[model samples]
Target: MISTVLQAVGLFVATNIDDIIVISLFFARGAGQRHLTAKITAGQYFGFAGILAVAVLIALGAGAFLPVEAIPYFGLVPLVLGLRAAWSSWREYRDNDGDDDSDGDSATGKGSGNAVGVLGVAGVTFANGGDNIGVYVPVFVNISHTAIAAYCVVFLILVGALVYIARFVATRRSIAEILEQWESVLFPLVLITLGVVILVSGGAFGL
Candidate 1:
């Protein structure tokens, strides 16, 4: 039991450590908006729940549900999201030229950009997690249902912890300033790059 618990912790952290930067970037754009923070958190949970569901299904003999090679197609989710974000950023600049009170959709002139709200966050989270699906399927194999439940519980708890830690980093004054300044550029670029990498690295490109 202890071993299972430890393994769950180790596996989850190892697989999900990279999410810190993404989650932090999301929080950085919150700009003290508590509602936005709640949205981000809920979106994250929603996205991860989808991932877990897929993994569990595939592990439980639902192989036909999604062929292994098709996982790369998930990259499309983030790729499109990135493109959408980029478009919003560009439009914001073109229309308002960074004016804070120009009556743009975001009065702040520095909101996280359009299309990057709850569903957008959730979509990208699900998209960027292609690898987690690959790792989780095999890990769930042959394990007792009890251990699986333990793993899931531990994983969800740690996900909340991950969000809190990233939020702390994002809320730091210095980091927040930089993120706010470049969020328009950085967020889309990061998302696009992540998508391309996932597609290419999966060893089978295209739908």
Candidate 2:
């Protein structure tokens, strides 16, 4: 049981890779206030929990209604999403702002906004969680429904905690800048890797 739980947790963490990246962008943009970070984090946690629970329950309770074969189709969703991100990243690199500071400065010269509204936060959380759901559905298809919910809850809490920590670091503007400078190369590399992972998981190589 313990090992199963650990495996579930690990998968949850892996599934949330895209969420972490999107939230990092929000932080870099300075979108949320100190308190707002907590709020948004909470929203993401609960939102993810809610979504996961629903998926599990629906799979269990409505198993007869769903096309079991559709389970693998979930993989296609993330593949498309990953391909989209890859395209976006390539475009961003091509349009690389010539005057944009490569040294952690905001390329658009825009201040991170303080008033990230509730709906906006929810929207961001949902958008960021999209890939997670895609990864999860396929994994949960054959698992016990309750186990799926448990994994979802645990995964969400971990993601929420990580987001909170990242936002806290975002408050320390100097730290954010310094880390970004040193890790700048890593950022694009991560984006590229995420794209590849999404495609691979979706069976794009076989397709």
Candidate 3:
């Protein structure tokens, strides 16, 4: 039981380290907009739950019909997403001529008075979590359903805690400033690195 609990903690942290940055940005958006914090939190959890559901399904499938080794190929989803993010950032920078306001506008979706919609945030979370499926499938396949259930419980609890942490960091002026400044560049890089890590760890590269 203790081991399963520890495993759950480790998996959550490993899969979600980048989420800290994403969550912080959402909370920062909330700070700028009116009463968006709760929405962002709900969206984030909704998105995370989606990722978990997909991973669990894939894991279950892997036990029967799917080949375990093929799991690493899923990393390509995040790799492409990361590359697209980078390309978009480059295009935005070039188009805006490096204007800070433009960056703010893009990050915060300025046209909208309210925070991002629940589905919008969920989409971001799901895209960002593409690599998570690769990591989670094996972990889930190796364990019993009972352990998986425990992990789910722990993950659901931690998702809320993570939002609180992100909100706390977002409320801080300096940290929020830094996130806004670098998130466009940093987010893609994190996704790219995660994809590479998944591929390498899973031996998908045949290395």
Candidate 4:
């Protein structure tokens, strides 16, 4: 029980770090407002729930028809996604002239840009969720279906809470100023770390 709890806790943190960072960026862009944040959160929760449900279904259906050995390779999904996230993060830090504007906001722009448009929000969420799916593929082998569902529920709740907190912080004059001051350095470092961690775990670097 203890080991399982520890594993779950570790997985949760590892899988969600990049997502938290990206979401915080949007919040920094003023997507942090209560209404838009809630909308984005809702879209993410629904998307996550849908994806997790599909994964569950695949696991169960395939259990009756295929060999279990193929399961671990399912980690590859996150491996690819992690690489993409890393690249995106690196670009955010390196390019400097591509995406972000004068205010250090993503080129998509602030206010309207960070509004969490369906496409943008979904894309970001999907990319960030790579690690979560990878972790789930392996963990699902040991845990029950009910446990998986419960974990998904808990994850969504936590994500929503984090979005709320980040939005609030982004709205603060002092916090927003601080975030703007170190945009380039902080985003790259955080994303690079997250990318490496996810890739290593997903067996992408041959590690």
TM-score per model over all chains: 0.89, 0.54, 0.65, 0.56
The model with the greater lDDT, 2 or 3, is 3
Top TM-score hit: 1
TM-score of 4: 0.56
Candidate 1, poorest ten consecutive residues by summed lDDT = 107-116
C-alpha RMSD (angstroms) for model 1: 2.3
Which runs of model 4 end up more than 4 angstroms from their true locations? 1-10, 31-34, 61-114, 180-207
> Under the 3 Å rule for N, CA and C atoms, how many clashes does model 3 have?
0
For all the candidates, what are their Cα RMSDs to the real structure? Answer: 2.3, 6.8, 4.9, 6.7
* lDDT values for all models: 0.79, 0.53, 0.71, 0.55
How well is each residue in 58-175 modelled by candidate 2, as lDDT tens digits? Answer: 5555545543333333434334443444454445455555546543323432223223334444544543444555556667777775767677657766776778666666657886
Encode model 1's per-residue lDDT on 1-207: one tens digit a residue: 889889988998898888888888776555655577778878888888878888888888886877777877778887887788789888878877657668634655454454337787788788777899889988898797787788888888887888888888888899888888887787778889888888888865542
What's the lDDT of the predicted structure labeled candidate 1? 0.79
Per-residue lDDT for 1-207 in model 3, tens only? 999998899989988876877677656444566557777777778888977887898888834444456656656655766686677767666776746566566545333432345765666676556577767878998999999999999998998888888788877888878766666666568667766776677778794
- Position 98, candidate 3: lDDT: 48
As for candidate 2, its clashing pairs are: 30-112
Enumerate residue pairs that collide in model 3. none
Worst 10-residue lDDT window for candidate 4 reads 107-116
- Candidates 1 and 4 compared: the better one by lDDT is 1
lDDT of 4 by residue, 82-196 (tens): 3544466456546555544445345433323224454445544554455455457666767887677666666666666666766676667887787665543454455445445
